[model samples]
Target: MSELNVELSETERSFGLRQIPAGHARMLVIGRCLPQPIGEVWNALTDPARIGAYFAEPQGDFRRGGDYELPGFSRGTILRCDPPRLLTVSWMPAHGNGGELEIHLADENGATRVELLYASVRKRFAVMDPEVNEWAAGPGWEFFLDNLSAHLDGREVRPTDRDWQSMEGTDRELYEARNTEWVRVREEFEREHSPLPSPE
Candidate 1:
């Protein structure tokens, strides 16, 4: 297995490291810590307006047992909610490839540790080549979580900003390097965990 050589930032937790076996599908968990209390962190997540500041602009009902439409993208159902602690939802994409999105909040010392789990993702690309799917989910979540950290640091939220494109040139360079490392790590992880050959 290849070793990762890049120095990752504190906020660079991406999807390449979190693939786990989940029955019929793979489960991906991504997490980051915001230097804020759990209550405030929870507010930012559950409050639709504040959520839009970092991630997608959530519209329509987004509460427990309500139907949620992710900004202008997918239609989902809010399966469960425990204020400031956990949330579970199902995302049904436009073309019908979707999965369960679960968010967990916990107190880490004083900061809020935010863990997001997306399970049973139905992406054909994952079957074709598992590591390839990281390209689709990793960087975007990294950007959004970084935005959350920025927001908690009292920086104004740039509601519609993207790293690879909208970020300043130097910033994108760093992100590109980080993304490259993520892909490499994922490839190695898959190789290291692949099933062994059966005896002849």
Candidate 2:
């Protein structure tokens, strides 16, 4: 399979603060269009076999209220599952910074549009440390979308961990350039939407 270019120009990213039961959390919204039908895109996201092909090997029950784990990535419960439309899950990583993740799918023209929303509580003193900001989540999701695109295009999809380690020459440079663009986008988001006060 041939490699696909990392294209952020086709993606729409937004950031905001949302009030959840726990408190105020940072929310990252990423929207992108896939060159496939909505049903195909939805299946790739929900089917264990298909997901494993592009994303991670998901284990455990897949229904609402069921628990699931993405091996080394994250483990969470399925909060909601609406076929070919919306999927919401609780996201709990090993770092213990838990959050909620929502995947919304829609038909755009003849293709499918995917919107991924992740909201995690802001860590205390997060402002003191620039590295802890929510913007850090941007690149990971972008990488996933890129992988998804490749899978839909019938190309081999490299696992995130292996992809980074194996990337070289132009591929590695492209990935780094994408990361830099994400940083700029995050800065612009912060300037336009001031963060909400940290919940007491």
Q: Give all TM-scores, in the order shown.
A: 0.72, 0.82
lDDT comparing candidate 1 with the true structure: 0.61
Evaluate model 2: give its TM-score.
Answer: 0.82
lDDT (Cα, tens digit) per residue for candidate 1, span 1-200: 22222325454343322222222444445677777999998888788877776667677776777897875456788888998799888766555655667889999998888887665445332212333323244554555576777766778654443324455664555556556655664566568756422112
lDDT of 2 by residue, 117-199 (tens): 98878453112124442224666677788798899899887556653435677656655656666566657867887755554
Model 1 ranges with Cα > 4 A deviation: 1-7, 12-23, 123-135, 158-168, 195-200
Model 2, 118: alpha-carbon shift in Å?
Answer: 1.7
How much lDDT does candidate 2 score? 0.74
Clashes of each: 0, 0
Local accuracy by lDDT, each model: 0.61, 0.74
Local error of candidate 2 at residue 189 (angstroms): 2.6
Model 2: residues with Cα > 4 Å off, grouped in runs:
1-6, 122-136, 162-167
Which residue pairs in candidate 1 collide? none
Highest lDDT against the true fold, candidate: 2
- Candidate with best TM-score: 2
Worst 10 residues of 2 by lDDT: 125-134
